[model samples]
Target: MTLLIENASLIMSVQDNGRFGFMRFGLPESGPMDWRAFNHANRLVDNPPDNACLEIGFTDASLRVEKDALLAVCGAGYQISLKGRKMPMWMSFWAKKGDLLDFEKTPGGNWAYLAASGGICSQVWMGSRSVYAIGGLGRLLQRGDRILIGKSIHRSRWDAGWFIPQENRPAYDIDISAGVVPGPQYEWFTDEAQTAFWQQKFNVTSRSDRMGYRLRGENLTHRTGADLLSQGMVMGEIQVPPDGQPIVMMPDHPTTGGYTSIGTVCRADLSLIAQAQPGISEISFIEINLNDARDKLTKTIEDIDKIEKPQEDVWTQL
Candidate 1:
């Protein structure tokens, strides 16, 4: 079984959870931008949480089902159609052999995910199929790529009506107010800069990519001369350069950053920022306490855990 790429998006690739244990050697954990959506898509199709899926970024894609299979699409900014008929997002649907599937961008988000009943088969490096082109892990998917299906799910108790509840899904609003915890260098910025950071809005500049999102807004001045030695970095770190424009480190960010970090977007709200597009999204961040942020993250994980957790594998039982 396979899915043939007819027209791939600008950035489409097979990504599992991420590559771990190599970050110390300058590799970034390049997974799906919306981890929650990615997991839900897998869950709906009876795949394990870390199963590899197709990540579609900021555009449209077209594929043909080479075999009869169940599929699910989740995340924001796109709508799916099977054989030219509209399909629901966050729900599992069946695709017959030779059925054409199209993912068209609508609005209000950036990344989308597609998962089949069986997980995708890809060459894994360092225990992950996630693509990190800069580090040579894998490359961007092309139009002619053939994505082979993994193990078959024997038909037993499979349900096609599985869907992620609305409350659990991301809002994907045009304007987002994300919550961030103070970083180690929070005090590096002036008091005015700190206040403005919470009050002023920033437009995501076109100078954005999988690496980082450069924001255009008020010039945040530094109190300590903005001289911070290069430090280890992670996803969602808000680094302000000498120009005062802040750049939000993404999944493919460098191993370390030299600029001063104002704060870090919390896990619960990081996906909102990730789904935001450059021109259409305006973002503001408010301070979140470490304890409260931890609770929010715990809640997000619990919500994903409750979504379509498979009961039992029919093949395994037989």
Candidate 2:
């Protein structure tokens, strides 16, 4: 049998490829906020893309294993340990019955991913296990909640030698060298204000969440300040309401919004924006042309594919 989670400390949920095509009906794409990092974590465990994972939030969550299993923990800084011995993040490790796997909140990043050999087997909603926190539909793991495990991973190994170690961790800087193309509302801004947007720096406000990041910077302005009819929104679309401050949308952003969007953050750099932890410091936006943005997006995807978490594939030898 697969290992069970006897104690799920703080916030935890099963997230997979994310629910899509429903935004037409006003449902947000409520998948892993940092999907690139999450997918990489799964690959490290040899699990294919779309395998569900425990989306550990800002709070450090804890759990007790009920059986032996292989697991990989990835994404932002977090103190992970098994039965008091230190465990590495972004790499696979073993856990046995009664072994306590604990995760502490990261000082820099906003989320962490915990992936098992297969994945978390929770009741699916709309064909996904992603917890839409506002909908109250998917699994919202709580204390004393015994999570059901997937099938037992009979045979699997880890390539700890080849994979990169957690010590020399990759850096996630908020350099906005790649800004989004100004959208349908770009004409509304004066030339001077548009210049300031790409020139000035903005600090991530304390009110950030999975929904959107409220930025505090030079007052981003528009000529009309008039209310507009609600329109479609995607992650990274910077929506400016009446206050002139921009709210960068995230995975769970609303399907439609009435606010005017001056520009959007490119998909390639969305994670950088998502990983901006509260009180971390100032983040500046730099504008990049459309062609450059597309080229970068293609390269990022290929780079992630090359960095597979070798633990998952080891099972093939069994």
Give the best candidate by lDDT.
1
Q: Per-residue lDDT for 249-307 in model 2, tens only?
A: 98888889998988888887787777776666566777777898899778766655554
Clashing pairs in 1: none
lDDT of 1 by residue, 1-318 (tens): 999999999889898998888778889988888888898899888898999999998889999999888788999989888888877788777777899999999887888899987799989988899988878878999998999988666343355656687888876788899999987788988999989999998899878888899999999999867768888999999999999999998889998978899999998888898888888789989899999999989988888756543334521221
Flag regions of model 1 displaced more than 4 Å: 154-158, 308-318
Q: How far is 197's C-alpha from truth in model 2 (Å)?
A: 1.5
Number of backbone collisions per candidate, in order?
Answer: 0, 4
Provide C-alpha RMSD values for all models, in order.
Answer: 4.2, 4.0
Residue 185 CA displacement from its true place in model 1, Å? 0.8
- Model 2, residue 161: C-alpha shift (Å): 6.3
Positional deviation of 297 in candidate 1, in angstroms? 0.8
